[model samples]
Target: MDSIKVMMDIYKEDRSMKFNIFVILILSLCASLFAGTADDPNLIGWWNFNDGGAKDWSQYGHHGVLRNGARVVYDTERGMVLHNPKAGYLDPNEGHSGHVYCGGERASIADPCTWADIPRSYTVLMWIKSQMWWTPPWPGSPNQFEKEWQAIFTKGTRGYGQLIITTVGTQGRIYFRARGLQPSTNDHINGNTFIDDGNWHHIAAVCEYDAVTGQTALHLYIDGYEEYNSPVIATGSLILCSDPVYIAGSYGGSTKDGEIYMDDVRLYNRALTESEILTAMDEPIPSDFTGDSKIDMDDFRVLAKDWMETDYTIASDTGGMVAHWDFAGAAGETTVPDLVGDNDAVIVGGGQLDGNGAAVLTGGPDGPYIDLGANLGNVISDLEYCTIFIDCVWDGNSTSWQRLFTVAQPGTTEFSTITYVSVNERWLRYYQRHNAHDEETNASNPTYVPEMKGQHQIAISITKDYGLYGCTIIYIDGVKAAFHTNLAPCSLDLLGQTSRNYIGRGPFERDPLDANTINIDNRFAGKINDVRIYGRRLSERDVKDIYEGVSRQLYFKLEAPGNLSDAESTNSKVVDFKDLAALVNKWLQQVPLLEDNLN
Candidate 1:
């Protein structure tokens, strides 16, 4: 009997076990139980790394969660998990000054690693918030790669994170190195830049088999909206062996090196569709009122509609849909200067545009106004008023400058003051340093102008350029400036004409041909956000109101809100993969139920 049982066991192992019994059991269970929600197809695998085991990751990597054949980096400080690399950083040899690859496990050292069998195309996503910039060598530090990797997005020296790609060769060879695959493909994002600090940001990179029509894409999402994208470019095979993906650092063969914190690293075998990518990048909550993936009026409508249906218990992402007098609405009332020949008015933040491009002073067919009507007579908004706040970056640069709107002094019989506001060349230039009158007369080139690069914030007010109805008042942020000006109001008034209104462009002056002749492309570089316009002149109270209002508006617009449950009641809802699947299943079930009932 024993021999017979052993023989039977061998037979069962050699030949496939009959499915009769197992199949019957599975069928019975299926028939008896209710169907559960469908499984997520795109969730390749999830790893908390809590289970310390060598799981099979041939499909993703050799060591399951640990790819690149690297070891874990355990930091006693803050309990951060680091990874080992094939090489480490050591002082450069032969007076190179640049550090050389030490090649081994070392304490408190950051190194680069490679990967194995790189796939042709894939998508990589991760969450990283870092303060590594404050440490070690600066950008051009030794023992690091010569050229800095391109950041998908970044905050600056203050500390930031990014998703990037690069080549292995010392010469600038572009390839997808950070996430997956290498060696042979036509699509790649070699060296990109995307960094930010003290903030959790989502970064994703997608590559397609067909580089042309289905060109590869790299996205950097800060907060939510797709902040940046690269030109459609083709890449090669993404397989890696010796070189593995690096975290808190980069896979620079030899270039920029730094540290950062990362969470939720993910990779998709198949190139996810753009729509799916959008779903993954959005505010995780839907503030995109337009459904076009942007925070515009349509989205506002959704929030407004939802809020009206609910009690004050529920507020939209922007708190009751960007109000009129408050951050949730618009600035309903503000102080306006009485119209003398050339009076100045102060505007605070949170002022809403009355018309398309309301506060913008544009040039060309529309004669002149701020901003070049980039959004079709769209007033370029530079400030959002809420409550009392301080703004020092105002110069002319998009980063730091102020914009003013003027009505032009009553037309002088000798030379119409109206001409100042009716000129064709409305342009942009960096306003000179504050309170500095030494170089105000030089219209051709001001000594203290704002630069185009770097991050900045500017104030929007009315300057003295346009004569008639010059400036009724000026709003700082969204607040009404306390001091008014016909001769001297907000501050710096050396350009001749007083009573300047800060709209969406540079200050106004008596010389129509000289002042107010600026260009948008030339000025207002980088990005613009939270635009508002008011009809009344801003007072000190108004300034405070606008500052707080604008701050709250911007805050809610960018943040995830403290009261999520209340937010969900309004338009600030977050629908994950399960929600999508449930919706689809519900629709599918309806037809079958209807058919059965009819029969």
Candidate 2:
């Protein structure tokens, strides 16, 4: 009986031990999943304000104490942002009222010595939005202009070691100060870029301290680009004080009257590389189907099946896409094949396919241009309803009026054309003439200018109602830039006219009196990519999608196994089990490196 009891006790002990081991294993796995990696070992403090309180999510335990109504609020555009509403204007008598204070007993989980290291380098990153420009006044300082400095973050006492960051205005300027023992030799750096435009902007300040000489090098980055660099000079030893760090409002007892919103405040013990900063600013690609933060295997598979194809198809979404000149062909191929209709464009003059696979059009009479033969009746018949999308890069050669796309009958004063007028190289003009009424009318949008040396996506939509006046809307890079109503009732008709449509050159000559001559003076000097024309008006959302590079088609032309052309097709082949397997292999392992930058 004693031996049997002993065996039973051993069995029970073994089971309990196994259970304990299993629980430990599960806990370790969970910790590893939730803990951040050592990729940013210098990251000592991080406050995302996502917990609806002053808790530090960095696991650094540097909790904050919110004072004077400073609280975390939900922002539609941004997840959770710190909102510091002003109590009142700077009344020297009232003292500083609102701010988030962190440090002391809640000192960062990281070693405080590293932060105080004289020669240590560090980077501070945060996203801030503020409209008012008012800084807390320094105690006993009578200068009211000093109140214009709005503090974003600060540490240390007034006469001791101090570090301060503040914004001057909405013009993208920032001012930073790092003072050591000697206040007279304090380091001051100013940023040139503007960020106070009522929008959320990523701001980073990097400081490299030379311990040997006590010299500091400072650099300011706005939206990932370095906007200012201070000259290296002596600024005394950077001593870390026992005072806590204050955010949104200054440590000094003065209140800022305006409100400010801040999010994702981080402090790194080392300077972050430019590439890392860029990675931080980049927003995750919006996933449509899976709702994942990245383009995982599932999303990639869906994108592959409809690869390279646009969402709007010729036969479906976009009504009657008469012409679609993709300008994609062999390296030197001059002819641009029309993807939808039969309006293929024949490249004229000295034209060649550029490295970017665009039709490079030079300026002048001999410059390259596309000839869309006289049969554009399907596109311009009604003239009242039509949408044209063009992707091009301007060369900044504003010597003469440049014709982007135009349609007109040869030797006739009655025609419609889109041109970049010479008076304001940035303005885009649409002119139409009705032969029946012998009237010529024009509409221009001054703000629709393309960046001189950058790529631009332009969409023009024209619509008309029977009794109401005709309307023309111009969208640049997906955003509507201008909307104009026709001065007179819509009477323009290009139906049966023997019209000549051209891209990069005007059908009418420079001499307005002689309509028969070709106007080489207004030739476009730039690269032209996918140019599509629809006989019906397109919605603003449709234009925005196209601008953002959301396509539906996967394959331009079917190729046999191993003979696939990477340029023509977005996906190598149809998505199947192999693609699924690849995705499964990656699984949750493909997280973005900059996820720490966001809340």
Candidate 3:
């Protein structure tokens, strides 16, 4: 009977635990929904060089490249030094290892001595694993046994293990050594500890004192806990070694070598308190992203927060995708007029919209000056007022598209008339038949219109300017349409005009007018597809509807697999991550994701 009651109690506790977890999960979901986007600027910093070479440090101090580029260099003695995503990692040689060659004019790949010229009073944190041991003898040192080897080396006089955070000179040293009359020059082995076994340990030291200290004021953290500090008689002048500092080794006069693996080394010029240090050291494994210490949802929260920013390094190994508008279009191809990707679209070139909101559809008879791809028209509905995406040409003829569009001061009140047409049309056949908008030999404003004779991406959004007369906003893509006041039920009339027309060069109504200067040739250039259509007005949630799914896989026109083995094989051919992501986006648009409690 007693056993049964105990089992019942255990089951009750289990249920309670599950209930708590359920509550946490629900709260997390709510928070995620509310915290749609939160930019974290603290993740920004300069990733210094760790090339396993003496000169690599020169990049930061003198020739440092701050971009998110990684370099791996190996040396016979130094083992491996990894400079990736701007952080440094180093592995020791078989038996011996350290940064900076013991005695050499030139540094071999095995010997790297490039210490970053970090600021004074900074925190140094990193993951260290070692199997090298050194403890004071039982009786003591040759004279008196010290406790531990000094872990951090800074500038101070008569090397005393001051243990102060960010030691500057000879007085700065933390280690286990034999107690004795402290040796003056470099012979001072006072209080040095050797715990360099093969076990991985996190070592961090923060030097806040600008000068030497005698009390527990100087702090040192080993695997997150603060170690005892020695009495400060701080009065050394070790030159902070402004040049390349050493790792796993120290060199003031002679050489002190250490065997260990160093990974995730970081330095900050601020002294963290004991609580902060403890929090950092005790942080769960794989939790810290920037290595500044505290870790929680903030790390994972960065993805959506800075979706449009390139502040942190996206882990390519994790299949993380980062898209920035860096790839311009190729020559002789217009791009912006059509949809570029299943996710976001880039609206490249579209003739300017005048202050009066009038855009001459035919670009000065050069040809049809505007083009609204068939698929794109399907995606955009309820167009009233909204921001527009367009690449415009500065046709030295300031009067060209620019004069009336961008030049006018807002109060000009030009109220230029523009037209929005809803046409059930096919592809480019109409324009090609007329030979009007020629892609052959036409160069209007090549500067802004990089692909004048080619392709471009463009979008015209009308939701933003619904109420404002002669106002307009456009985007390359409108998964969810922006809101506009005084919006009308009809899409075209929402533009303040009751117009119904087909997709073709107008006033092709007669002949292509040369004086009109409106030509589709000046429209846009690009392949456009995945145009979505909505009956009612939309919102932000509506836009999210246009695309679904966390991952996208591109479609390929390949032969079918011969058998089940081929289909189920893990080694099956696959597209790259970038293209796959785009494909996933396309699939999301086609079949929206089901947002359920489990997700």
Candidate 4:
């Protein structure tokens, strides 16, 4: 980068570091300008609850104001979230209703871009955690709060779509209720899971219409899995209300009586497929495609591999493998058979083939990932020595929690071992939270994340010696990138006897300090070509043999963007003005991804 070079030159001249603050400021400004965003063109409105206010982050900048006692609370993962968890509506009236008031009438309500038209097909998504399920003490008067349901987001009146938290008999669930515009025919859809356990849950309500059948289906998804699908239609259209859209409560502020913490409320013009909803982040390159990182054989190799169809079978075979997944299934395949074991993976969303050897995952903090089943914990849990190998490519630069591999318990408590990359791309984490409520993760560091730019072969091995010292080795493309030796029990261990395992997802993705799911914690976006689990730790040589000694899973098959390298191969991918011309000349011959800069 020219800026970097100038800073470096100034630093060398001054030696006293008078320009330190300026250099840091420039670096920060650059990163912020290029940070990933919610880029779906179909998105009409988005309220991420950041900026400490209810500002719409989408193209429609219809900013909203808080209603009633609604207030923004700081969260570690999601900077700010609406904290409105009060259920008291009637007798005591202690229950405070809160919402983001997007002012206007009907579809025009709070919409400056005119994209918020009521449609027959639409998708609304949000993350919620019910603080409590409090009801009026005396069930004496049925003052509309008699039912244990409150609207989380509503468009207009009873004839429009709304997402709610309610009780089905005794099941605390995420519910969807919608009514067609014409005759006001209604559909009340119920979610299967009890969501009031004070755990954050991702929920989406989609109404899809088949033009041929003239029928509409309402689908409910909780935590990336579909819980309910019901078809009810006789020609449908949303009722046009003069009511303004509301988040955290109903249009008129009369609802949202349910107490819950909410964030990332989104509205799409049309129904979105699960893959689209959970798609990975793809940022646009500023100038050079290579990011001006390095230009070695590795860069050339990454460029070549970008065009060539990846061969999943090339490294599919490995001795002593307890399990392996060569995601070479067809598009729309719901099942990805485990190549070496009976632990076949069930696809919830977008495990479809990438047309290449890898499998596509649109990438989101929520679903459309490969669920390796609860039984996997029985086989892969609690091993002192083992190797977890993955062949994949990541699209985005950072995620607060993007799980590459995770084995966690399924219940409210999060007992799990998670190998992940957090907000910064600098380190690879091997964490073991001994208990669900533990405040600290045992991921004090030992592994490293390479300066990865494109497809890569990553192998993490754990070997314990008789001396009770654990050696953690991380290899990138068969070469040892980082290695550390630490006393046993201090390092990460997959505690025995657990049942939930997944690829491209985390066990809880919850903060150890607060135990709250930031929702964006496990949004691993990229394509997973192949994965292998060895019962024993892999030696450096063994790891090399499995990979092509080169630069090489989902949680989708995402084709990562390539980076540009300077003459020295410093692995600096940031494109700057100084190297643009040289990068263009070399880009034609080296990295063939001319389109990499476009997306």
Task: Give the candidate number with the greatest TM-score.
Answer: 2
lDDT by residue for model 4 over 51-153, one digit each (tens)?
5678887766778887667777853223357776464433334233566777545444354423454556888887776663333121211112212446677
Clashing residue pairs in all predictions, respectively, total: 154, 14, 120, 32
Model 3 residue 126 lDDT score: 58
The candidate maximizing lDDT is 2
Error of 2 at 348 (Å): 12
Please write out the lDDT profile of model 2 over residues 1-599, one tens digit for every residue. Answer: 35334323534676664344334433443345335522355666777675566666564566787777788885534545688876554435536656787754225435454332323577788888764343221111111112356678777534343566876532235776666534444466665444543456688777777667766777777766554234335465565554567787765556332367888788777777778777666643122223222332344545465444344222332334667888878878877777877777888888877756698988764477888767765456654456789999877554567877877776666666677766565566666665444222233444444443558888877655312455566777876666665656543343335367888887665665665544545688888988988665555545666788754221222321221123322344443445344443332232231122111
Candidate 4 runs further than 4 Å off: 1-39, 85-96, 106-115, 132-147, 157-171, 181-186, 229-234, 252-255, 280-599
C-alpha root-mean-square deviation, each candidate: 18.2, 15.8, 26.5, 21.6
When sorted by lDDT, best at the front, the candidate numbers are: 2, 4, 1, 3
Stretches of candidate 2 exceeding 4 Å from the true structure: 1-30, 37-42, 57-60, 76-79, 86-94, 103-119, 130-148, 156-161, 179-189, 196-200, 210-215, 228-243, 252-257, 275-360, 365-526, 530-599
Q: Which consecutive 10 residues in model 4 have the weakest lDDT in total?
A: 137-146
Residue range with the least summed lDDT across 10 consecutive positions in model 1: 413-422
Q: Using alpha carbons, what is the TM-score of model 1?
A: 0.37
For all candidates in order, the CA lDDT equals 0.30, 0.59, 0.28, 0.55
Candidate 3 — which residues are off by over 4 angstroms? Answer: 1-120, 132-194, 210-216, 230-239, 251-255, 283-599
Q: TM-score of every model?
A: 0.37, 0.44, 0.26, 0.39
Pick by lDDT: 1 or 2, better one: 2
- Please, what are the lDDT tens digits per residue for candidate 3 over residues 184-222? 322122221222222344556654545445211234555
Write candidate 1's Cα lDDT for 319-417 as tens digits: 211111111222332322322112222333333323321222222221233221212111112111111112222223332232332211112211101
